[model samples]
Target: MNLLSKIDIRQLQVLKALLEKRNLSKVADQLGISQQAVSEQLKKLRHNFDDRLFIRTSNGVVPTPFAQSLQTKVTRALASIEDLLIAEEFDPKTISTTFTICSTDLEQTVILPKFLTLLRKHAPKVKLAVKTLSLDDIDSSLLTGKVDLVITNPMFAPNNYPSTTLYQEQYLCVASKDNQDIAVQSSISDVAKIPQLVVSPSRGEFSGAANKWFADQGHPRNVVLSVPTFTAAKACIAHSDLCGFIPARLLPDPTLKIISLDKQVPGFDVIAVWHQRSSQDKLHTYIRELLMQAASE
Candidate 1:
């Protein structure tokens, strides 16, 4: 048992590399050591394992049948250990991880304003990085470790990612308080003729309720402008008579009127998404809980 305890990790790594790359020089390069060192380690490994781990072939070293038999199990066991050691274990107030979040103009409008204030008050040390989900490659972005958190309307989930609804989203139109036409708001269709300000999160988002409303009704309203984000649309609507569709919560100004759409567009579900690596993380849970409570308010 004492002799078995003396067996080293370096010997295992060298043996695995020699079995994989086959050439002495290639394994030496992988281990960042000399070819002679690999030979020495290989000799030690053979004596300890009491097996001919590799056979010298005409071209390069080939693993013996016994070595091949142990390879798969050994590799998996080592990988499991590696994952356990490298996993993220977080503490919110003490954490200094810079978390990147992907959100739309709409999410930035509805969620971020309040969320940021909450963050500053509670977790000042935690850093937040914002990225617009500007492309359809959201899954790839998360999988490749590009983004940590995603806040999108109705957090629609894809395979390899889990989702939870952060909030319920309702849509309404915002027009300037002084705009005369807004005072006569009878129905959604009544304002169809108004110059519309629409937001497509991705440069050309044609799928939202605002974009589809006019065409579906066979009455194409005058679209004064098309912007990529709701924040931009909100700014445009603020200073002009152009009507913009926005979430119900964001219109905090008392001067602005809040009326739900008569036409039922699907309600948006705000969600937070991260890779499986972060799913069990404590800090992720803490931030998520805070956002969830904020949404409820």
Candidate 2:
């Protein structure tokens, strides 16, 4: 039999424990094995290495000169083996990989500024890739690793994917402060009659969340313009007489004023979604945490 084949990992562990403790009883206690078992492993290690390894004294066993010479090499070998058995811990500072996120303009305006600040502060080396949220391509994008995360309203999230609600958002009926047609306090029927700007990011159709509310009240909205993003809608609404409903978080704008309605539009949840495969991913977990923090702030 080969000398290398005769040496087992258990025998090496025993050898290391014995070298550190210099006492069979102490090594057994530390290793959770019996003293006799410790001695048996030591005996096998001695035979395999062809060295007495330790000499018994009145106090305890002490390593021989030959064993002392093997100490550094054995420690290094054990460390390498441990590296093989243990998982490497995730470190944000050391990460240099890019993370891609698909987000609507609402999230880009309201959530990502603070998120980017936190991400840059902690993980300066990590690169971020932002893609415009497209309902048509989101499923395949997440499944194929083209997108790592999707931040959007819960209504727009891909079905069956795992998601965490970052925050709840309510809609605010906003119009240009210069617009004289709308008032600070107006009934839903009143606003429904005014020419509205509908933000249809996924589709160019003049439809929106407030449409259902208006229809439920027997007064369908008069949507005159359709824009692809909230940013675009905001810009258009500020200059034109097209009043629109935007998320409350995008308020306090100098050019826009909120239109208080008799009935409020239903609020929606903003969520972070990822592929099922990334349920246990450390980087995804960290990013989600950062997203929640950003939303809270």
Best lDDT goes to which candidate?
Answer: 2
**Clash total of candidate 2:** 0
**Candidate 1: regions farther than 4 A off:** 1-90, 113-124, 155-160, 205-207, 213-220, 254-266
Q: In order, how many clashes per candidate?
A: 2, 0
Residue pairs clashing, model 2: none
* TM-scores of all predicted structures: 0.62, 0.73
Model 1 is weakest, by summed lDDT over 10 consecutive residues, at 205-214
On residues 202-282, what C-alpha lDDT tens digit does candidate 1 reach at each position? 756434455565667765667767788766767777778787677766666555554445565455767887788888778
Candidate 2 runs further than 4 Å off: 1-85
RMSD vs true structure, all candidates: 12.1, 5.7
lDDT of each: 0.74, 0.89
* Candidate 1 C-alpha RMSD relative to the actual structure: 12.1
lDDT of each residue in 206-263, candidate 2, tens digit only: 7787788789999999999998888888899999988989888888789998999889
